[model samples]
Target chain A: MTATVPGVRRGAGPLPRALHPGAWWLWALCLAVVASRTTNPLLLACLIAVAGLVVARRRGDAPWALSFRMYLLFGAVIVVVRVLFRIVFGGGGGETVLVNLPEIPLPEAAAGIRLLGPVAAEEVLGGAYDGLRLAAMVICVGAANALANPKRLLKTLPGALHEIGTSVVVALSVAPQLVESVGRVRRARRLRGGVGRGRRAVRGILIPVLEDALSRSLALAAAMSSRGYGRTGAVAGGRRALVGTLVIGGLLGVCAGLYGLLDGSAPPALGLPLLLGGLAVAVAGLAAGGRRVRRTGYRPDRWRGAELLTVGSGLAAALVMHLATEIDPADIYPSLTPLSWPEVSALPLAAILLGLLPGYLTPPPPTSEVPA
Target chain B: MARRSVGSAALGALLALLAALLAPLSPASAAPGLARPAAGSAGFCPDASGVTVVVDFRELGGGRVVRCAHGPQADGLAALRNAGFTVAGTNRWGDAFICRINGRPGVDSEPCVDTPPSTAYWSYWHAGDGENWTYSQRGATYRTPPEGSFDGWSFSLNQEEGSAPAPGLAARRPSDGGGSDGPGGAGGDQGGAGGDSGGPGAGADPGGAAGGGSSPGGPGDAGELPPDAESDVEDEEREEEAEEEPDEEPDEDVDDDRSAEAAPLPTEDAEWSGTDEEFEEQSAARDDSGGPSAGTVATLGLLVALLGAGGLTAWRRRRAAAASTAGAGADERPADER
Candidate 1:
């Protein structure tokens, strides 16, 4: 952009340009929604596999990018904890007893409550399925985080939301920076040969790390201010109020609209019309807000054909899943009592597979952009 | 005198209601002939007027059905048995598969099928208001059918067959009990099967056995045996059961709770002596057929996949860290030289 060249190529191949961060987020959200539609472990497994494959293939070599494994670790912990809770609470109904804990008979007052007794296989299974579904959604979010550049994503936000977006980008960068600071302090202490045992070790590492963090944060704040962080030009008070009202009102409308959109059982009056109204109000708010904040752009990101294709696949997956719920709600939470194969429809399954389209169509992240 | 009689009658009725509520498993005094206490469910299907039970003798060439108001039976199996279907089962898979209906048993060609069944046998399903059938996960004895729906027994020949096929024959429409009293349940006369044993005590009985015993013949000959020989066997069994029937002795003392509870009609001990209380105790029963949840198996696979991906990521991170540290050492030497 500084060189004033259009479509400049560093390499001769198609894999030179990085994918739009919006595309990654949109793709991940679509896959997460699909995971929510079914408790069928088979379908959920397929979904998790798709997400893992895509994230692995597309993620760049960045500190934030390395955090996806931590998400998986969190998911495993969630599943194990869920199963453990089931063992503790659920029993009495199912016949197949895996383990029999001591049955403490409560007084008649606690009629329905059972404590540490036989753990049923059915309960454990149900818990695992539920936990897996939730973990899948969480990891999908993590995948979006790993693959998308937080700073790049902040740029794509509407002007009205820029301040909020910037703060979020800063907050995300803090954890990795803190880890780097700790590593540096530890190495310095080792070189000085003063990392004493117990209390002495704590004083050696803790004070320097805290001091470093404070100084770095102050430096960052100074840099941001010098670069004109909040330099919106003087505006009429009425216009400011109107802009605030439009954004606030638009946000409330969007929340209500989203509630209606996600819940199919909600009334028609509360659904499509409200969602459309919210979107319209939000757009108007963004346009008004964009006028006041003036900043030089080094080449605004383009919404290319590939971006549309990438996001569309995800949208299609989510939309098809919502459609599937309307068609047969039973297919979602498959019953264990009857012991039949959880119904997996061809259309929804195909849509879930289609969600993987972004991995192929978008250009892979170039190694040069990654920090050494 | 009229006032006193009314008071006594009311007290007796109150005592009966009190006993019924207290016992939870007490048969209604109004219909004594209905042996088992009926557990009432709010019938969901508004359109369905009355109960129509269909019995399908799959691979046995024929089946039979009985139409009745929701009657007294301990559970669904007892309900079918009281309706005169000779149901058979092993110690395992309680009522999962009905081996016999109307004396026909499963053979080499035909098996008593279970759904996702290991063998070629029949599976029982109860249609609870909905058109779709629920394969009974709980034993029929534990679950009663919501009235006005169909309880079907279908034999699955193979694993791949369209599951839970309805009985071949249509359920018979409700009968008017005709001349032969068709289980009209003449509660006082205590007629029907038990009355057919015709003791001299029953002959002198004040209430006439008015209704005829009008049970339908099996569509299959049911291996028709000589009636004379069968009657003697039935008579011996009935006499033995009659001895075991409750309300045998009425106590004069009203204060004893046990006497009040045991006695069906304290005023008339004579009637209960002949009345057969069909209380089939499901003795020494344990459910043995359940397996590990199939969905859990799939989730375990999902968990394994997540762990594997995580391991790969960790391995790559360690390698990258090693290379970067080695380079940092090289860069430190250059800085010292400069």
Candidate 2:
């Protein structure tokens, strides 16, 4: 009889490795940029097409990835419901009245209610078009994720960010380890008959999770020191550095004050300044941070031409979306009123989908280096 | 292949529908009639100078035409007669007259109203005749540069039956044949410089009587015309010609060819004189017309799109689950004992 060893595996099946995590990040950025701009149907539809092309190229004819029957059925039902809802409750400047619902009165109430509809054709269709674009974008993103592996995500980080990257990777591992520790503690508690109720289980879980996390953090600190981290003198200080710090701090304070004065989501004048200030502070901090260890020897992998293509495609999609869509935040949801549904529908969903495409073609990390 | 085909087909139909639906409504694709201004602009905003002129036109239509100083021209019954316009109708003491073909909507310039309307509406004078009066009780004082001399001017009412007069050109005919030629009057008819009243002979004969008294000074003196006098008719003929031809430029760009006229204040001896909102309710009515609460369209679209995405996700999940189940079932077998 053949024996099976059960544990977490290093790599997924060879069906087709998912795109790199960088691609997903790019997709997210593109979505944000595209959403800021257009709701035009034509542009969105084109984006959807590009997303499809990406899917096709990444995964070799994965039939289920771009499933249409389910999507269409869902879309049709939603459209019908939306149209009916709008008809019943007047909206979108729809004036054509096809029928009215019988009035229903609350007993002894001053007001009674009746429903109204067939909303104008323009509003219904316009709403549906927008819905379609959003759906397309979402599907493309999902397909990209499903096809790409998460294990290789760290490969994309810049070498300068190795410590932060390592921290993040270790931090990610903590949750799973905590879960395992909790299970062990629960089992031990059960064996000792010390926990019986749901409350006991929560106590059991929390204690072990926290203890494990703390212990792991201590061990991490020790391991980092032993490995000669910060050997490159990243934190050497001088008066010039102090002056730089003071200047940056003062500028940041001023920016913070201005931000408080002009605080609002839609005001780019305010947001842009804050963003620039924050970026400057971050760059300064990075510049001033303690050194990288010479012996640690961590380096970001060179991006291949194929990888560049994937990233470039995502960037292109994002740029195009920014150019094509209406960037006015007001258009998305007008203030002091119910949200602007019609305008929201006009978002370039298809363009977002295209932007999601590059993530699909990104290469996954080599299976050999994956921690088991 | 079938799935791909279905996806592509649905995408195509969706795209085509979107394209067709979007053709006419975008600001970029505004209706041709209302298409003069490009996107994001109401057009232009004129300053106080423009506002003053519009106010002047309103005063003129409101029959507030008082006699006042105008530039350069001599004043007399003959001169007054030379500046006549045909009144279209009489109502509420104000008579509407057709403006010349090239006549501006009013003195207001384009700068007075061109933004897309943080607050809606651009203020400009529209020259429709008849009882559509824009009333202003602004009286005789007008602001002028500290160093400039004021010219006397006269205001009149005319009713041109079929056609409008040329802008700034009025026809005046002296009742007593004081002999002022039309637009470019000859030298002999100069009754007086400035807006002085005509001589005794010119005043005694009703035929030569000036329509209004001597011109008054200041800005509020923009509109003052006597109801009972006819002036000379020289420029009036040229106005008729100008009216016969259609204006080359758009209405917004139309400019006045004649100098602005302000009527003189009446002389004490001169006889014959005459002499006018529920905000909440209005707002409610306008609000009702404003159409559709926010994000209704977007929510509807989102719901539909999400439903589509969710359905697809579920289907894929189910299919994968089923395939895994099938494979597991097929692979399962009694442990082999060797």
Candidate 3:
């Protein structure tokens, strides 16, 4: 049985190990950045495909790993809702009328806002493009969730954020834990020959599941407290205040910087310079605060060549998309007035293909002993 | 079995709903010929029966192109469109916010995907004959320009609402050829100086000359003559016309000199004629014509290929897991018995 297990077999390949969670997050974020830049359905579809492929090839047998489909379903829902809204709201005034729904007249107070007007192909296509961009962004984040181990990610959080990380990890795990608890309660009920249906069955399962989850959380909290998980070493109040100020001020600067960068009319000084300065200050603050929480890792995930390759490929994809935006914005944002087919240029397509590097380059995920 | 049946029923209902929605879709008439107003000469409308559309390319550098939207137009947007110039609206605001005129400030300068920054945008103005330009409170789509009124669009860059430059040409119609030439000629010369010193010299000349009561001569200079020797043609026409109509001949000469200085612009005005068909064709080419290009096909193929690869990997992984689970179950049972 041990020999049959691929992970346990010797000399099969490089010993399977999970890549750094941060690398996956950075890579996914870069892909999301690429998604935000363009409304071209073709490019967005390419991005979605690349993300799905990576997630399929690299996701482990974990509860979160199975949630990518949920994200895809959610993305589809977004697209449907967006298109529906366009149909209802006059379809952005195009000549190519698709569906002439009866126009609903509103009171004089709600002038300029139409309801149930003629739907145009341009409007529907515009909504799809906008929705696809958003969906691509969501799926990229989902890909990261599936590819990276949330527990490992929590462990890798800065020492200053240990308490916050603990809360986040618990919150992240709650859905899966609730699902497990419900399953266990259902199985127990079935074993006892209680085949109640609907409301009664829900009542029977819900209470026990809640009780089980509460007890499990209590036990986890107790274990963590005993292990000194969130212990803060002696730190001066003045130092703590300074760190807080730095962080808050830095965050404010970052917010302003991002606003400036996104708004076309904003002054140039408020953009890149402010963003870089804020980042530097935030990093310094984090480092200072980290010293107060004296903690060590058992087996820390190292930033290896695989991690570099993963993050670099993501950055390359983002860079290429940005370049494409500059070089051929017309292709990136296809005109919808006449309702033309969305097209993707070669460079941007190749850049999105580069996003597939980590799936092939990184070592395969360690297989779980339990079948999923 | 119950769950599968329920799912299939829901899908069938969805399909039915889709069919119902699609049933109302009539075959769209391809490229409907829109009611476009006839292209007019550079000045205000020759009479009160039309709406003159003045597009001032301020800072964008093309000078003003005044075209008349003939007939009774419904609204400012309709008039602008009818005047044979192309108008592009922002994606977010639809026709509420005018983003481009005749494709000025190209996509590189302004993407037109969203509400343009307030600092740089086309400011709409309205004026009655001989009245000062007033900033319009309502959007172009909402406001109806009265026949013989002026609908102006000036590109406002880094200017406040109060300071936003109106169209350089004043709202003065051409005088009815006889005694009105005194005030009209004075207005024309003032407009000429304003046009010459501020931006391009050509836009103001025709308006000036037309207002000066030599309206026929001004149109003849711009429309009848070729672009290269427009100034010479204007001089010869001015001399001959001056001989025939000596009353406003001096004003026509002064206007001709200014028009001569900015001669190339009149050629543009002449070329701008018959743009309605061209504009429609351009839009049709952009919107309807092209099938998917090679790049689009390649992108779609790549997407499909990736999806297929991903599906294959998932299938292979599921099969491997099933095999491993069977092997593990057999080994565990034997060990338990032992």
Candidate 4:
């Protein structure tokens, strides 16, 4: 296949040389953080669309990539389910009533709980806003799943995490592989006699699927071992214990720091310092662990200018949303009273639009298969 | 005369209970004066030149006081802030867990209502025409007061046991609920305040609702201005006030015609808090006048544009896939033919 775009070197080895997989995860994470920062639907929608565009533009012809549509469908379901829950459980008192369900009075003990009460516009809007934020987050995770090859991403992990990353990568790849396996078996069975129903067919299909998964897992284990997977240098017991302690302590500090930043009730001291100290300790542990791992990679992925730009776009979106929330919190959490249009600020919205840059700026993913 | 004295004596006892209950909060509120400055006036509303907010501090012993403040669209929380009363609350229920109104905390006490327990929390009520109070169905953040109203707040100690009672306050004007309540023309004078005698609520509303709250000359001018025939015209203004939230959200006609900035400001009605209300009114004005400010428009525009780009990307990918497949089929056909 001929390269159509200028400045994209065909000598960059076969068209569509894979992007640094870490770039995709970083980008998706940034988009997710932006979604979490605001309840504004318009901003969230833009973030979702940008993710969708990037996924569509760059995603390889892989089953994991195809799963993006599933995320979108799931997002729609979440919104509908959230609204339904609000309709079923929401009590009266919101000014704008969309639908009033018959109220069922309960015993005094059930005072706060309302069943089948008026479904107000406010409740629906609130639910939809909340659902949309959650859906945006889910979609970001899905975009990362769809765009980045999990095995490729695992390859870029620190040497200390190499063994763990491989198992995780294999575990993730199994779902998509299982889906493909099931499809293949079904098609083969259809060729024989349009898959018969009842106990016989269930037995036939279940046996094959389980057998296929076992064989696949064995093959994966064999392949991993053949690649000199267990290679490690000797380390003193005391030093190993120290590394473990630092790693565990750092993880706890990070957890505490994260909770402090996200929760208004947590103490002030647990926030920045704890996060920094935890990160410092975790890095030290990672460095120590790396020394014990005697391993090399095949053509390790380079972090180039394009990779930085891709990651930066996502971080930029998150930073912009942070500034917006700081400047005007009211727009982020609009009032539901006297129901009117919730105001959206230009700066934050502009920032979200900035996420669209990678969709256009990065070289388009080369089609994997040669057409002619 | 003996029965009236007994009633007054009961009222006096209730006040002492209220004052004692309020003792915890009075330090923070530094409440202007508990001593009834006059027989029927004091506490927030000096007299009834504006809307009277009745604080039924039931947990702090139930008695009510009248305070003048902005209506709900202007944020009733601002009313507490305006009166120099500090309110402690959690945003958990969006400012609904108002544990302390002034310094008296309803939570973390000896009986300890941990955070937001339903048994002992602040409940809200409102009285329109200053007659009978109605429970505010929604939380304070979402429920702005309707036209010509009195705001009531009560701290229910044990609402789980039974219904919380409205604070039996003497400040409430005795209700002879007739005449003035008629459509559109409620803006006209009632000729007499009746049992309320110097009733601030009745005295204040027409001037306030008709857009006169901004001007101090509001009440006296509304009192004398064509009390009989031109009453319905005042009702038309009051009717606009009836749909005031809608009135506030949109620009020009209601505001310009209402502002009447020119020609000596003819007894401006609508009990607007002027400064705070004007700031909110300006925001609303920007929204209504320009259809939407640049921020909203850009947000919407960017959203649509990004979605469109996503669709375009999908389309381009599809076309590329088709072209490649077609190219492959053409090449394969020749090889198979050979």
Residue-wise lDDT of candidate 4 within B1-338, one digit each (tens)?
13222322332342243234323332322222221121222333322223445554435542333445533334455444444333444322223345555434422241111145566566665544433344555455545554334566666665443354343332222222221332223211221222221123333432212211112242223343312323323333343223222211222232234223332211112211112222224334432231335666666576556656566556556556556666667644232112
In angstroms, how far off is B177's CA in candidate 2?
Answer: 28
DockQ of candidate 4, scored on C-alphas against the true complex (2 decimals): 0.11
Error of 1 at B269 (Å): 35
Candidate 3: tens digits of C-alpha lDDT, residues A160-236: 66778889988988888897677678777888999999999989998998899999999999998898876666778
- Kindly list the per-residue Cα lDDT of model 1 for residues B1-338, writing each as its tens digit: 13222322332343243223323211121122222223222111112333334454434443333323344344466556544344544211223334444434422322222122433455555532212233454456555554344455555444343333334322211121111222323222222222232222221222311111111342322332212223323333444333222211121121133222332222122111111122212211312223324453444454356435533543454455445545546654222112
Poorest lDDT segment (10 consecutive residues) of candidate 2 chain A: A1-10
Score candidate 3 by TM-score against the native: 0.77
In model 3, the runs with Cα more than 4 Å from the true position are A1-14, A251-271, A369-372, B1-44, B175-289, B322-338
Question: TM-score of every model?
Answer: 0.56, 0.38, 0.77, 0.61
Q: Taking the true A–B contacts (Cα pairs closer than 8 Å), what share appears in each candidate?
A: 0.01, 0.06, 0.35, 0.23
- Sorted into a CAPRI-style docking class, model 3 comes out as incorrect
**What DockQ does candidate 1 have relative to the true complex?**
0.03
Error of 4 at B200 (Å): 29
Model 2 lDDT per residue over B1-338, tens place: 45544555565555455444443333322222122111111101111011111112221332222121122222221111112211111000011111210112221211111111212111111111100111111111111211111111223223232111111201121111222222222211322221222222222223211322222332223343322222223222322232211211221122122112212212211221111012223323433223333454444344345335433433444444345445556434222111
For model 3 chain A, give the 10-residue run with minimal summed lDDT.
A1-10
As for lDDT, the candidate ahead, 3 or 4, is 3
Which rank order by DockQ, best down to worst? Answer: 3, 4, 2, 1
Model 4 CA deviation exceeding 4 Å by range = A1-16, A190-195, A231-233, A255-271, B1-295, B322-338
Proportion of native contacts present in model 3: 0.35
How well does model 4 score by local distance difference test?
0.54
- Between candidates 1 and 3, the lDDT winner: 3
Q: Which ten contiguous residues of candidate 4 chain A have the minimum total lDDT?
A: A1-10
